[model samples]
Target chain A: MRWFNFVLLLFVTLVLQLGVGRLFGVGPQRVMPDLLLLLAVVLAFRGPADQALIACWILGLVKDLSSQAPLGSYAFAFGLLAWAIVRLREMFYGEHPITLIVLTFLCSFLAEIFVLFICSLKKVMEVESYTSFSLVIMFSAMLTAGLAPYGQWLILKLHRQLGLPRRRIYGR
Target chain B: MAGRRSERLSHKQIFTYLMMGAVVCMLLPVRVTNHLDHVLSVLVAPFSKGSQDMSLMVTDKIHQDDSGEVPSDTPEEPVDATIQDTNRLVNIEQELKYYKDLTDRLSGLRQNQSLDRARLIVAYITGSDSSNQREVKFLDRGTRNQVESGQIVIGWPKQIYKDNILNDEETDAIYEQALSGAVVGRISDAGSWTSSLQLISDPGMAMKVAIEPAPQRREDWRVKGILKGKGLGQISVHLIPATVPVKTGDVVLARSDDEGLPMDMIIGYISSCRRTEKNPVEWQILVQPAVDLQNLREVVVIKR
Candidate 1:
């Protein structure tokens, strides 16, 4: 596992997700992509399962701290998502760009669901306006899916520069 | 065969460890995290400053692109004397008009205590939180600047008056107390060098607002009501006493209660209002914030 490079990538993603993403949103809706989750999903396929789960946990912890959402919610959500994505890839995997796109959409959706479930259970925020909320979630998911491949490529490049061994969903 | 099982067991173990870590994190005292947040804000202050400057530059470029106009910061371009004269005239006109309006808004505050300018701290918005949380934004000012929680945040909208309403006199009378900037939110979490501001658009945020029709009108015509945030740039002023002459397009301004904010700062413009079938005694009014919050980049916090 390219643990050092992976952590570095996650750190950069965390900083961007914190506030820099504000630069990209447009229109009245102000949609911001979930870059941390995007990276976690990409790492799930490209890194060793164990290291990726650890990365997800750290990323989630950072997110929980940065946001007003209840602590442990994102940590649990991200860890569970990483674990589940790894299991899914091991069971049924593809190597094409479509695989990356679909995985991002699915993983993002899963993260949102897991976050909502945990938050609802904890009762920190009331679940309201499903129509608008889901639309925003779907917008973010689609936006993330659209950009996931390039991020994967960029992270792969960083790994290569760091002399880390590359792993894929399936053996060549 | 046992090797795979061992790996699976290790995976489970890691999961358990992560959960326990989260639990430990949650178990930590709130004050500890607040202190940690202060430290983190200080550590990131320099980076946040740089990013904020870059964001302003980027936003300027975007505005230039959308309007197809030459950016004002293009130093290489020849500066026309006529253009400079025109800009000066525009500035003078705006200042004159704003002061004229301020005269009316301050009339409301004249009956009350005057606001202290010494208490104002100009702060740049270092970053903004995404949609995952409430509509809160991070400001560059923090405890290091003696900016603590419960401070009032205000933003100056470029527009002098709310558009689409022809009643400029009545609107000016309602909004004049705030000078130029409208109340944005409170400094909810003040860190060491950075603080998060809960924007007025955040859900469940409630405040008292006064609705007035004309300058120095009778108390019988004035309405005091509660404005609550519904999120996504929507706010509603609720339960106005039915006797008050509340209308769809009336301007809503802060009505000082316990918050001690100046009563004349324009909260928003009421876009629509209706009496609920369930409660005809109350009027529900939808308000559009004076400034388009999506476009707000910088603000000032009032310590008092």
Candidate 2:
């Protein structure tokens, strides 16, 4: 993969996620889509296995660096999710739009759950209620899932630039 | 087939090792992680700051359009400029008056020493914590500007304008009577050129507060309570006796021992007050911040 292009993409997404993404928040909870998580899923679907693992870890590390979460929280979530996706890639048509959406929703939901689990283990936050926090995770996952198809389409358009293998859902 | 199976197992083992490495990183010391966060934040400060400025500008334009005000992009005529200048002068004069009043109160109480060292560092909002579980804003000011952790961050009170029978003198009077200090957040982490503000609405936040009389109330009494954040832009006061005459719209003031912030800075006003269903002896009071904390573009970080 073109590591430089991936880094640039990751940096821009991180900035946008932390800055402009707040404007798109909906409801009182201010739930927002997880852009970096979507990117990790999309890249993992199309990139080589070993490189994708490293890339997902890096993406998660960047998120951990910017957030109040403990270091490696996102890294662990993203890495685990990417590994699962890679292992399960052969079972499904990974490049299908529906596949992308479902994968993103599940990954986003699980990533948040994983992070929440870590936070709970650490006793870092004083959450008002588990149900409310779960609602946020669900809504955010749904939002990211809704945006996944479009985001994936856009990224695939740059696949050659990003040095990813061609889409092969239907065959070589 | 055996070779392929072995390859998959090796990959699984590698993945396990990577996850273990991540756990190791998570277990790293807080100081090391904070230092790393500070370094990374400083490196990307420019991108975050630029995007935040652009976002705020767009939000302002949208708000202006919704409010039926002239768009700011239009060229300002001399009269508009004059009006803007006048408004600036008025604000400065009002601030001076507020400080003077504070000084008088402190002097009368013989606690004026802390006021002498107090300084307000104006900082721009850069970004915020992107996690769903946290409510934090990133500021463009940090340790370089004496913005240490626990410094009180405040915003200007929402201006109250009268619709009818308002002359310049009446307007000035209303401005003068307006409660000035509204605490928004506190510095949770400070880097070289950036810091994170733990908003008062975050569930983890709790501060000493008092229910005090509004301007119209002639009675001089204070009921001290612990103000706790309830998340989703909600804060509540606890430990107040139900016998106290606490009502909606009563101003809540910070009673913190932090020297950076002056005493009695307005934290919010009671939005709801009701007796707890389980406990009849205490009042469950919810507060709405005086200023819109979510949309704040700039804030002053008090340093002492």
Candidate 3:
């Protein structure tokens, strides 16, 4: 994958995720779709195996930088999630938007578990009520899944410029 | 065959190493992680801030279109000339007392070594974190702008009093609207060009605060307590004696005990004051923040 394209994608997703994410938020927790996670899923399913995992890890790290989480929290989360997606891509049709949405929804939960683990280890979770915390996690995953098709479509359009393969290598 | 075999193992090896590196970062000390975060954050600050500005502009435009025009302050109606002269004298006297009260508060803050003459730095909100565990907002100004950690941040007063003398009606209006300066949060982390504001509602946040009677109350009652964030847009003021005559509308101020933070800044109003069922000696006071924290567009950070 082209490094320039990766950086541009990361920058735009980060801006959209943090800048206007609040505006699209629903409910009191202000839960919005996780744009970077969707991008991670898209690249993981479409890009070269080795490069996509690293790019997803970098995307997670960028999120960690912009947020108050421990530095490697998102990095580990996205990296592991991407690795899982790459390993399991052969099970489903990669071109199917429904496949991407389901994967993103599940992977978002996987990523959140990793993040919550790191935060707990760092002693920062400090969640007062488990019910509310669970609700936020559930809503965030659903929201990301709800918007996955559009986000994936947009990112996939840049595949040629990103130097990624025009089509998936699996489930042909 | 050898080359293909090596390539097959390379992906797993790389993933293992990257995961290990991430673990190391997670274990790294706070100072190191913060510095690294700051360096990377600077690269994207401009884009994030630009996006924030555009978002604000679009929101304002939509509201304007819906409302047809922006609201502006209208001039006060003229009154009887003789009555106006008498009111002016009373206003002058009231203004003098207000300034004196302000002086006393400043002196008290000085005595506590929390503030030397207060300086206000206007900072714009650039972005916010979506973490459920913490309430953190990003500011456009940071150390480069003399904004340091622990400095008090205040929102625009709900009502900017037009006249110095507040009559009974104006005084009620001011208190009902909110305090003269609404304490929103404090700078929790400062970088080269950006900082994080931990809002008072974050569960991890705790500060020394006091509850005082309204301006009309002649009974000089000041009860100091510890303010603990209860999350979900609420704060609890603890350790105040249950015997204190605290009510729902009493003003809560940031107590000067916290070092380097300004004193007597209005934090919120007591939404509920109840005797703790477990410990009747203590009061369970819930405060509604004076400002709408989630919608903050700009704030003034008080610098020493």
lDDT of each: 0.64, 0.75, 0.72
Better of 2 and 3 by DockQ: 2
Report per-candidate DockQ: 0.42, 0.54, 0.51
lDDT of 3 by residue, B180-273 (tens): 3467888988998888888998766888887877554646778889888755566889889988998887778775434545446667778898
Clashing pairs in model 3, backbone N/Cα/C closer than 3 A: none
- Candidate 1 residues B10-86, lDDT tens each? 75577688888777766565455544554555555556557656775676566554568756565522333322232
Put down candidate 3 lDDT per residue, A83-156, tens digits, no spaces: 88888888888677789888888988778766766766776635567566566777888889988889767767
TM-score of each: 0.78, 0.82, 0.81
On residues A87-123, what C-alpha lDDT tens digit does candidate 1 reach at each position? 7776555457788898889878777766655555655
Candidate maximizing DockQ: 2
Model 1, residue B215: displacement in angstroms? Answer: 7.2
On lDDT, the candidate that comes out on top is 2
TM-scores of chain A across candidates: 0.87, 0.94, 0.94
lDDT of 2 by residue, B82-198 (tens): 433333343343345456766778646645323224565767777778777788888888888888998888765322221122232343432332224367878988988889898
